[model samples]
Target: MRARTLLTWANGTTLAGLAIARATGATIRPGRDGVLIAEGYTRRIPKNTCFTVGSVIFTRRTAEWLLADERTDLFGHESRHVGQYAALGPLFWPAYYLFCGYSYAMTGSYGCRNALEKHAGLHAGGYDPDHPLRPWAARFRRRRSENG
Candidate 1:
């Protein structure tokens, strides 16, 4: 079910979510299903991720970007979760396992090992990659509080 706010009688929105989308190339499109995943037939990604807004698949460079503490590329971990959610909707959990080596990241007690946490870590690494909070984003990996 789509949220009333997400549907403003239109199918697209443009906000100030620049940093995250700019580096990862993830865009915000309007749809009842929520963030539409392009470039695939399956409704879910093939990994383990922290969030559910964007795709999570990453090459060595992206993986290093997620794991590394550097600030070269943008959208470190949190952005990946965004990709996860954008790519996989209902199947984000099972899809997260496809992250390859992210489980070790979220299994600790100090920092974030969940996909969302990781995404935040990456985006907020040495610098702030994006806004502190994505007001426009849905619950993504989790359901809205009103539903429960």
Candidate 2:
């Protein structure tokens, strides 16, 4: 609801996401699949920053870097994700994962990827939000007929 894009990143990547969190006032922590997940994401890693399970917390290393580098836009992105996690609370993670899996299985893509990790790995190279494809994805249902 709050975030439009997600920022997803792999572990061992640069601490850009973490830096963004600290500067923007976000809580960061190690997350599944990727390292962090804010509520929303920058245009970079837009699908791994959404912290669906918990609040936006950052790792110690990353926090340090952000304090040093000083990237305003990146910081703002992670900050948005922190707010998103606060709004969604615990339900966000489970719900998001379930859907992501389904999306991946059905379409061979990660259409349900959160809106935070898009700009995650910007420091190194960057994460493609639409990179992973989920084939055989379930079709969006609007309604159903009574008897056919």
Candidate 3:
């Protein structure tokens, strides 16, 4: 494994991901490019069809489904997140949740304004690439524009 991959394990995020996968009854398997796929995560609350932590990508769906031809972009999107996890180490969790809160506040959607999601490619992650802001946020933007 490369240093970046090693870094994730060293930081414990990869192990945490694997633990989460096992806890949720997901089937763990190797994926292309040194990443792991954990499929069939049974939790319904988070709502995202797929999410990545360190070198592992967890999905509520099958690996085949997430890796389907048309969903190649989605896989790529999640793979980019692996790099992010490596870069951010354990800090990725707190940073990501902060982004989620910021996104929800601005757009009423968790992924819309999230910097991590934006950097990873919103369309590829099954999110609207040009999601509109919430009504209040739009009004706030308009006010700021007028003031400027």
Candidate 4:
């Protein structure tokens, strides 16, 4: 079997086991360009959010695909996530959320300090590292500046 197919299988298996993909009534299919896309979950995931498990992409909106006829910046960004899943296996999701929480605490943005997001090019994924600070973060920053 092709390497890509094997990779997709591995991702799909892990995601299915975790119930991250293949949620009830979800649509699963291979894209024209060979990417595996899954959608239609009843979960309240944010719109336009797309997450990858191994080589399979779980998305709320099918039109949110980063890849198509050619790879865009978002494609390159998400491709890093696929590599991350391949490397981390079932641990990827938990580790990812941990990083997300850390990033949120540090920078008031989920992707700002996330290592994976940084490696994947945060701006490439439409994220701003210097996004406006959260209320608490803003106050902290203001206090630090005043003290300095």
Query: Which of the numbered candidates is closest to the native, going by highest TM-score?
Result: 3
How far out, in Å, is residue 33 in model 1?
Answer: 20
Better of 2 and 3 by TM-score: 3
Poorest stretch of ten by lDDT in candidate 2: 5-14
Show model 1 residue runs off by greater than 4 Å. Answer: 1-75, 97-148
Clashing pairs in 4: none
Candidates' lDDT values, in order? 0.35, 0.40, 0.88, 0.65
- Which candidate has the highest lDDT of all? 3
Q: Please, what are the lDDT tens digits per residue for candidate 4 over residues 32-117?
A: 33456665545665443666666666656564443454447666676667666666766777888999898888777788788888
Which tens-of-lDDT digit does each residue in 1-148 have in candidate 3? 3766788888998999999988888999888777899998889867888899889999888888887898899999998898899899999999999999999999888897999999999888878868889899999999999999
Task: Give a tens-digit lDDT track for model 1, residues 71-134.
Answer: 3233344443444444444355454454423444323222234344455464343323342322
Model 4 CA deviation exceeding 4 Å by range: 1-19, 32-34, 40-42, 46-48, 63-66, 69-71, 132-148
lDDT of 3: 0.88
- TM per candidate comes to 0.22, 0.39, 0.91, 0.67
Runs of candidate 3 exceeding 4 Å displacement = none
Give the candidates in order of TM-score, highest first: 3, 4, 2, 1
